[model samples]
Target: MSGETNRLLGMAKEIMAQPDGRELDMLASTGEQVSVALLAIALQALGKQAVSYAGWQVPIKTDSAFTKARIRSIDDAKVRKDLNAGKIVMITGFQGVDADGNITTLGRGGSDTSAVAVAAAIKAAECLIYTDVDGVYTTDPRVVSDARRLKTVTFEEMLEMASLGSKVLQIRSVEFAGNYKMPTRVLSSLTDPLTPLAEEAASGTLISFEEDKNMEQATITGIAFSRDEAKITVLGVPDRPGIAYQILGPVADANIEVDMIIQNQSVEGKTDFTFTVPRAEYAKAVEVLNSSVKAHIGAAAINGDTKVSKVSVVGVGMRSHVGIASQMFRTLSEEGVNIQMISTSEIKISVLIDEKYMELAVRALHKAFDLDSAK
Candidate 1:
């Protein structure tokens, strides 16, 4: 698949042209279509009725954002028709069609998002997402040797974990499942094929809408870290009306997602404003500010750090427990890890720090909050 993308890119380079997002989608979508067709063929080889369909055939509708499309809705009539006929309907994920009939892909973890959306559309009782790992863990196993796999997690906590950096589930999938109150389970793709259906179904971490009272709650459920973080500061801007919008509006228009915003107190009617964006968009975001916003906003200068990372502690138990942030800060403070930025929500607390200190921060915080021993 990447070979095909590269071929297209190489052709474009020869013609002195950049690959258009639309054409890129047209090429990248072929990969998923191939997988679906092969799966359908394999199922048919077993003497089971099966059919394969592309996103446009399933008509999974989405906004025409090209590379980073959003699922607007999905038409399940064809899928239901095939299923009612006792055929296994295999459809491509990650890519969908727009009202104008153009193919578009959901960003990096689109497959999971597509699955959850389709499940909700068809009113499926539950959606199981099969991945490389057995289930969601306290943290990445490579990062923490004793990281434990969770049997179940509230949708709220999972959402925070996904957004913070847990790769077991994509953030949008968690958001979709939570929004629709849909039951989603993360299962291991490497499970034995002959395992009992009942036993297999009960395996993995269930992202449930309700907390399991039978399980003891921990103040911190997991440690999530993102090395793909970058922070940008619009320094010395006027502390007046619409200032935040003035700084961030163009950024939004550029389709660069911003996170963890901070505004310092007004000093003589001027303040320092800072926000974080994905590391990949760091340069583009800085370019956007320099060319259009800098002089207009009369700011001192635009500064950014592409080598930063975000580490977070997420848990629903924080609503009842206190000192989570204090403990987190103290833990980092003791490790001499300097936090560059801070953001918090009811169920989570995230800190942006030097990228080099990310692992040290995660290990220390994981142990400090007793996540290593958390069930």
Candidate 2:
């Protein structure tokens, strides 16, 4: 409660306004409402008239899902009326109203989504996302301090990074910006006012279309690592049509995501199948499969290991590149990184490696692909 009070006070100060005890108590939905109000006050202090509004006030209507609600529509008439009234409208980013007329909150960092949605609705020239970091880095700075910051990145690359584990931006926000062709700039909130918003500046990364003609699209963009993986192996199942479905249907019904499936050729009319799932759901997955499929298929047993990690190299450039997979395997092999399983998409090649080797594997791949260089 004290933390929330201090946050509201700080926001009020930034906006050059005295803290409103009543409004704070009634209107505060998330920390972002305070931020919007503060920003509005700052704009007002700069001689611009600004109006702060909450999600309920703006009435950003969304689905019934709380804490991850998808925006169904925005009552643009209300927004246009306010903007035309010479008011710089400030709105809470991640919260919305559901069909049941209930207030819903979009999950973590949904502010980015809110900002882009506003930009699209208002047809703004650009959307600027301010954050603590100057720009996206080649690798996490904490893990690789020398990781260089990228001046600019394409939407495809940004999406891949966000899905892979880059915390700089959210994936849905990027998708929204790209779909509308709304120019987006990511810059440090702490940077000096004189710093330009171009990719050449030490400001945040600019996510936009690439214009270079000779930039050799590499097979891999950057290495992404995740430790939330588990392996499930079903041994000695009868090899026949529809057997795979029989084994995986229940798992899917239970909403467990299965990744990197491998099935061996039939040996004496039986086959061993293996796949990966999120570690947190491994036990439920195993139990479901063992109970439902084991007796029917006369399989040997169900087994799993929750201590595995997944690392991948993602880049749309890989569509035209050859031998990238070979190079990646060779590099990891040189480092003695034992790969347990492998999977690939047209743009990404992922491998399951021991959790202990994650850092070394990423560093090795970073060097091998020359990712730290300013290519």
Candidate 3:
């Protein structure tokens, strides 16, 4: 159990005045309900009324997928009735039900989703998310030591950052906050509890819908890297319509997510195609493609490489700027870093470089973007 979980549990016990009480757990509808119940007891000690409720109890309805359930609607009347009756609701995040009434959970980090849902249901003025980090930094502090904490961040920029992989806040939570127009504060729970609430400054990032013009913009927002990638090569597929589909169909059926695909024109009426997928699914994808598509396309062979990483430069400012990608490529070239593949979005640019060059590449790009400088 984490310290925060333990503290909440201890607080629940103190408030309840009973070692064991009827607690509701709003868990991920997966398993975090155990932690919720434990925390309820801790809340009791602090003289705060507490109860843990699962997504089913709070009945956060959504689609029936167990791991990545999407919430459909919440019956807030029951929640409001409980809160009005003096109950501190500890509901689970990440799982809900569907019209057919099946248990589903939002994917990973759904706990943040649960927090925002509860806040919105109760119309709380602010939703404070306590995490390990003190707050949101100008850039990832681990990458840029001088990365300063932002008092606030706009919803759109934060969404782009989170989607690009700033794990401080879940993308869904930010979306929920923006939709509800709620002010969400991300704080570190590690701060001293004895300090006055006002004096206990929030150390992490605060995400809101408004932007601060006074806050100078950094050319790059942060550095995000992912190693969960695998490259796939399909040799000698006929140059024709639906060939790409015929090749990728089985991989999709096998639930492998393909990324960064490239198909070159056929040489002598036979073309070569390549793409990437999650490293874990590499074997399955290759197996399916080799077994099914290979014979159909007269493919010579299927090849897979799991030892690759995608490092990206993310910033909303890039939308208005030119030469960002060129500068990134130049910096990597100057460092003798060879890029294997490349991908880009309006707000982000990602390149697949040698895994060995991951850190060196990130540092070079960070410096090139002037992210290490104080704004």
Tens digits of per-residue lDDT for model 1, 84-107? 999998888889998999999887
Ranking by TM-score: 1, 2, 3
* Candidate 1 Cα outliers beyond 4 Å, as residue runs: 1-26, 100-104, 211-218
What is the C-alpha lDDT profile of model 3 across 71-103, one tens digit per residue?
667778777887888988788666666666566
Per-prediction TM-score to the true structure, in the order listed:
0.88, 0.81, 0.80
Q: Per-residue CA lDDT of candidate 2, range 316-369, in tens?
A: 677567678898999999999999998887667889988888888888888888
Error of 3 at 61 (Å): 1.2
lDDT of each: 0.87, 0.78, 0.74
Best by TM-score: 1
Worst 10 residues of 2 by lDDT: 19-28
- Candidate 3 regions off by >4 Å? 1-31, 82-87, 97-104, 137-160, 163-165, 170-183, 198-202, 211-219, 265-268
Best by lDDT: 1
Enumerate clash totals for all models, in the order shown.
Answer: 0, 1, 41
Candidate achieving higher TM-score, 1 or 2: 1
How far does residue 194 in candidate 1 sit from its true spot (Å)?
2.5
